[model samples]
Target: MTRVDLNADMGESFGPWPMGDDASLLKTVTSANIACGGHAGDADTMARTMAMAQGNNVGIGAHPGFMDLAGFGRNRMSVPRGTLQNQIRYQVAASVGMARAVGAKVRHLKLHGALSNMASEDAALARDCYEAALSVDPDLIVMILAETAQQEAVRELGCRWASEIFADRAYNDDATLVDRSKPGAVIHDPDLAGKRMVEMVKAGAIITESGKQIPAAIDTICLHGDTPTAVQIATHVRRALEAAGITVQTFDGR
Candidate 1:
């Protein structure tokens, strides 16, 4: 049976302001890329998320981004490579500490938001961030955007990693995700997103918005849990993949 992992970003809630429906989304996703302090989570939030993930038997991963809580880490910022490395290290370490406190261990590391976008295009930046994570835990599986510089960096580093595709986002011809501001960039329909994921997994490639095929290692599919309908989309995608004879499970970092 062909197997794939279903993952979602979680623990973005900061202080009194809440974000996604993490409890509901947790049941749908096999892996949770939890936001560390850098992006949107605080120490308490991270502890709560880690505990929830542990109770749900979901794989835990550190989601580190630029220190831009103001923009939710979506706004791009140019920082020195050394600084970026240190920031990632700090965030991952914080996550590790939190997870340990809850008797859970972080199994992977994924770049969040604009940091991810930048790393997807710049191999040097990808290397710096990934290297930082590896320094913290050599066995950490780096979840990277498939067919981009993020993947290239993992290949160069020869570390255990997983390649991912967005379930609700459109991809450009060059394999970068389309800007979210553009029309049709974010697919809100559950059925459409689910079907698209099935096709991409079956083909083992990314089907771009312009109908271009880019062969990639599709080990995991990312579903965003930040929207009102996100859980619905995640449920549909899981069902669609299973209906297509694909087993949804956590990736083994192959």
Candidate 2:
């Protein structure tokens, strides 16, 4: 691919508690996957983030997770199927409505935290979430973790979708992200993160830790905005992609 999208999980700051330097990160990313008051954001945070994303001309997306703010949505939960679907719908609706109110529009949908990890492995979970979001907006692009059950769910649904790899997370042989608690799972070095992303994008595949290249439709690279060096990684990744003659821009979901 000659081009790819740079996206970040954003709008995570809670009331009276700020997180991440979103203002600086926004200057580098092409798309913003905003939290929808589920895992890490509130109404005011969503409005503020969407307006800033619009001002930056970045694409906006709904980022919903298990409504476990105490766990930051990283700790998994076991809820009934129908209730989980409704939770996703509720979060997505809030995001879409808030964006419209701010004169911005959500173009895509991405799951967050443990919800995303589970969906990456379970097609049923991923489809349920995607279907719930689609029920609200048919045109919303379902962003999937490439080479996983998430992608399988998208293909089965026959919906507009984009496939993404991570800029800072290590991958396993099966294309799953290394557990966050594991050592070296999350790359904190800006230069190393940039190098890994460029290599994966150029190869048109996810290069696993075992040196396996799983050919896939790589569309975007995700940067974790809550990390300490999020802006640095974003900036360097964009620069690295450009230096390698790969255009860093928004993804037009297929």
Candidate 3:
């Protein structure tokens, strides 16, 4: 049977601003990518999220990003290679510490937002992030965008990797995510989103906005927690995949 991991970014609430209702979302996804301190999480939020994930038996992952809290780590920034590697290492290590405190394990390392996109195309940034993740824990899986330079670098380091696909975002012919600023970039309708997800999982391919079919070796599909209809989209997609006999689980669980 084919299996795919359902993951979402959680623990984003920092200080007085509360983000997504992660506790509820935890019941839905098999894996939780908890945000570390760099992007959008605090010590209290991290502790709470880690405990909740442990209680729900959801596998935890470190979601590391640039140290741009003002931009929510979505804005591109120029930083030295060593600085990038150190920041990623600090965030992942912080998350691993929190998870271990609650008796939970850090199963993977997933880079967030702009850093993730940059790493996909930039060999230098990818190598830095890959090295940081392995430095934290050599056994941790790296969840990276497939068909990117980062995947190649991660594999060269002998670390396990999971190919990540987005359920709500449209893709270009080159298998890159369509710019969010463009029209039709995000599928907000739950039914349509469900249909797209079903097509991708069933065929192991997705048709881009330019009408080109792209093959994806998908081991995981991501649903952004910040989306308004995220829960509905996640629920419907999970049901659709299950009906098609695809098991939902984390990479480690598989």
Q: TM-score per candidate, in order?
A: 0.98, 0.99, 0.96
* Candidate 3 lDDT, 118-237, residue by residue in tens: 888876788788898789898888888866777777767767888888889998876777877899888888777767777887778767887677787788889888788888888888
User: Which candidate has the top score in lDDT?
Assistant: 2
Model 1, residue pairs in steric clash: none
The local distance difference test score of each candidate is: 0.93, 0.95, 0.85
Please provide, for model 2 over 1-254, each residue's C-alpha lDDT reduced to its tens digit, 9 standing for 90 to 100. Answer: 49999999999999999999888989999999999998999999999999999999999999999999999999999989999999999999999999999999999999999999999999999999999999999999999999999999999999999999999999999999999999989999999998988888878999988899999888889999999989999999999999999998899999
Each model's total of backbone clashes: 0, 0, 0
Candidate 1 wrong stretches, greater than 4 Å:
none
Which run of 10 residues does model 1 get worst, by summed lDDT?
A: 222-231
Candidate 2 — which residues are off by over 4 angstroms? none
What is residue 26's positional error in candidate 2, in angstroms? 0.7
Residue pairs that clash (backbone atoms under 3 angstroms), model 3: none
Give the clash count for model 3.
Answer: 0
